[model samples]
Target chain A: MIRVSRYQLVLMLVWTVLATGILTMPATMATFSVRDTWLSSWGILLGGTLCAGLAWCHVRLFPDRSLTAAMELAFGRFAGKLAAVWVVIWLVITLATICREFGVFVTTIALPNTPEYLVVALALACSAYLVYLGLEVVGRVNEFLVPIAAIVFPLLFVLALRWFDWTPLQPVLADGWLPVWRAGVVPAFAYGLEFSLALQWVPYLNNPRALPVDILLSAGISALVLMGLVLITDGVIGAPVAYLNYPVLEVVRAIRVGKFVERLDTWYAMGVVSTLVLKQAAFQTGLAEAFRTLCGTRDPRWSIWPTALLVWSLAYFLFRNSADVSRFILHTVPGYFLFTAVLLPLLVYAAAFFRGVRPASRAGAGEARR
Target chain B: MIGLAVGAAVLGVLFQGWQAVRYGDGPGAGAWTVWGMLALAAVAVSVVVQARWWPDANPLGWLAALFDGITSWIYLGWSA
Candidate 1:
């Protein structure tokens, strides 16, 4: 059986959540809560912690199965298949959007001359290969890249201290807690809700006993990093950040020490772009796993490339330009995430409850027989 | 370059799937049938949406557009 150590597992968990959030959270949060983006990040903490808590509860109930498999036990065969298929659809479009989102960032900012489709295709290609190799290999790659992101992101924050201003964050909660609650209610929760993917791999962890602590650390760490990024991006870029698309990029672009080291957004993108690709890979892995369970596939490998193809197609056909990508990310995505990650799962949980499923339910172990 | 990459992906999935089938992880007909269809769907992306209300007339997009309204109402009806 494939196995990953806790350290690798934790890093996979961290990057799976942080890779997308690091780039967009500051500005995305600013779009709603404005100058109080930092305070608004409390939504991320609470929602992330709660979302992680939900995943933790999910695995606790279905200890030996994936989300689809757990749903089979919780709901029953037909309903479970229906729910899992929708989850698959969610994975397909979300991965498509992630690819498109990152592809736009890369072509626009990093590789100005490269074709966007090519960048997206290259990412799906890498994902197909790593996913066929399975999560252990993907975990190892993340072990290296997450630390680079961990270090480089913080280093950028420290270097950008030259432009950090406290006045922008002042006039705190001028609009009261409603906007904070609104920002936290959906957007931040959706970001944390990405942790839903981690539940798919929990049953395979070699040391399964430490699962909650690992998830908690992952949640706490991801939330802290996002909140920190929000603080620095808003502090450095000020109120304009609310309207700007890539606040963190501008923060890094603004750095200039003795005129020697500016234009470091390229270096920053170098570290983050891998994290983004791996994020898509990581999501593709879980998506394929869910696909396998629903299809009764002979092996996990059957689903990888085919799923990659679906995502590539969706990435191409979904959005027209960066504006379409941004508008979808800002408005459409959170609710869709709410559907698959929160509401759908809660419906299954309700089914489990109505049917007398418990945290210690042993229905999980024998679920594969179905 | 794109052709080579897509070809590699197709072959890579075949190789990986073949290994599992050889090991008798399970049998192939049903799984491979579905895989072939999906791979074909991916390769023929432009053809899939040849004529539609919008160029992006994906079934997945339809589902998202459908349920997003329902779920958004469920989640955002009172809050946010």
Candidate 2:
């Protein structure tokens, strides 16, 4: 079993949440709750914390097993297998969507003439290789890259402060709480529910007991970063943020720190891509592990290539363009994710409670005593 | 585009076939075969749709439309 420190896991989760959410959340939130977009981010933080708390409880209940194994323990053989399969499918789809979004972002913002599939293939190839190397390498890569993101992200926002206008965020909650609630639901489910995926990693951690704390810390940090991004984007571009494909990139491009600091979008892109790699690697690792656990494969590495290829194909063919991708993220993903991330955990915990399932270690001790 | 699709289909089949032969019969091997077949089928269908029947029949476009309709319905009811 590969062991990763809680710090590494925290960094990995933070990068995973920030890398993707930063670029898209602003525009998505602004679309629904124009001036009160920042409030939606707070909603994500709170919702994510609740999801993370539930995941932690699930992990504590079955300390020795993965999420799949725990599901089997809680739901019984056939039904648990069915649920596991569904979760695996959801994980695969999430991986594909993230890969697709990364490809679209890179192609649209940077590589205009290059084919989107090529970018996706290259990105997936790198992430697949990381998955093959195993989770330790993924954690290490995040440890190295996340600090750079941490530095560049704030600096980019601060430099863009020159264009910040308070009027756009004025008359906060002007649209009533309903739109804010709706707007918050997207990011809340997208980023918050991501902690549910992290449940699978708990068994591999050096200190699983620290997971809830790490989850809360990562969620808090990511939420603050997202809030900053939304605030900066809305403050800088105002209502126009909803119109731009990548409001963060646009904000970065608008930054004119002195004369030489112009066109920092390349730097910003590098940071984003680093996070993308981390996110994709983390998801790919989870997918490979899920395949190994579900299919009874001898080696998880064997599943990595097949999963990567499937992700590549799906990402390539999933949406007509980025707009379609955005629509799915906004309109569809939350509901699906709520089922898997929030409701599924609650169900598993309730089932485990009723079944009187003890922690694996305690159960083993009892068996030995008998 | 046709060549690319055909190439992807052929490559997927070959890759999966190689894995099945190397790994022998197991769940992993079966999964490889299934994924390979799915890829092959997807590409083959895309080629048929785009190259022969309708010149502008983008498989992804069709998929996007279907997905959008389903998701919109799920989230906002039929009126949306």
Candidate 3:
């Protein structure tokens, strides 16, 4: 199929992880770990990289099969289909939740006059179109967008140094390591394990052997950026970061370079939106592929529109407002994602090993039989 | 709001008709039919909600409220 360069894959992974977390990570972590929020991020980085590494091993063991096909090979046909269905449902819900998050963020912060449904509808339209274009287009688009984010993100950090206060992060481990551990769970599940979605793209990669290294490198870079944002938000905004809904947005809003460079929050918003588009494209593509596996279809393009509509409807009517959305994100999403992303892979890997399933010689050919 | 709902319903029906013609009895025809029906139903419900036809009978709102209630109970450890 669709082939993507290692560089494209790394950029896609980094952008997808950074998309939604960048805005809320600091505040969410601060709420739990307080001054030790940055430390908690380190735990997330390590956990996420480990999860990626585990996924790499699984892919290496079964180079031909997508995660869904591998599940079938490991657990037999019927049971594997059931597990694959669960993964697909998880992916669909995740996509809906992400769309809801984006809609709420835009309506609350950027475009108050717009209806949430309208914003979500437009986003779904764009993302669905991108998904229809296939993985190659998505990879290239990410290749273009990631560089802008890479440059602007660090520059924003540098400019905000005027407001950086290291005193707020003082007395490290004041509450001991438990709170930090608890705090790390949010980012660990939300950002780290999300790379599980990358498993779907393994077969499409040009050089499958490099997938693990690329994923690890991307996870490390994303972790550093996330940690930097948390540090800056906690330091500049101090303890109050715990109360702010979007601490990173506030941090960007506070940066005033003379008069011309003020209101850089708009720039930050643009970057977040770009990353979100890429993330949605990735999720939508994965969902389509999952559906194809389920329906025994060769093309997933026809499935994209229906899926987009379904996601839009669910995201629109699923929650009362942003508060409910946030509650779902904090309470429900972590556990749900952990089960699908971390535990499911481990289970599949164990099953595959116990069954002694050999790696296929040609990708997709063996998978087509099952 | 009612006008918007009506417009959405019409647009959804038109899109589905196009899809049905374009992909006649193809791989995704069934999906197109199901989604088209859902889009229409969702818009109709929105219209009803906007019109306040049943006053207190907004199913989508009720569903959201019910979910929130369940989540709160779970968060609060099911206090009696």
Candidate 1 segments exceeding 4 Å error: A353-370, B1-47, B50-53, B56-80
lDDT of 3 by residue, A1-370 (tens): 6688998888888878878888667777776767888878875576567666776777667775578767877887678877887887678678877898899889988999998889988998999899899898999999788567769878987899899988988898887877787677668776777777878876677877777788788878888888888988988999888889899999889999887879888888998887887899999988877755554445666567766776776574455577766766666666566667777878888888877776676544544332
Ranking the candidates on DockQ from highest down gives 1, 2, 3
Q: Give the per-residue lDDT digits (tens) of candidate 1, residues A271-364.
A: 7788887889888888877766765554567768756765675576667676776656655666777667777777776777677776553334
Better of 1 and 3 by TM-score: 1
Question: Which digits, one per residue and each the tens of the lDDT, describe model 2 over residues A1-370?
Answer: 6688988988888877777888788877777767888887876686568766886787678765667767777887668767777777778778878988899889888999999888988898898898888788899988887567668767878888988999999898776877777677767776777877677775567877777788888889878878888888889998877888788898889888666868999998988887898899988877766655565444567667656776676665555677767877876676677777777878988898888887767334222110
**lDDT to native, each model:** 0.70, 0.73, 0.73
TM-score, chain A only, candidate 3, equals 0.95
TM-score (chain B only), all candidates? 0.42, 0.44, 0.44
- The all-Cα superposition gives candidate 2 an RMSD in Å to the true structure of 4.5
Task: Give per-residue lDDT, candidate 2, residue A204.
Answer: 68
Clashes of each: 0, 0, 0
At residue B7, what lDDT does model 2 achieve? Answer: 56
| Model 2 stretches with alpha carbons more than 4 Å out | A362-370, B1-80
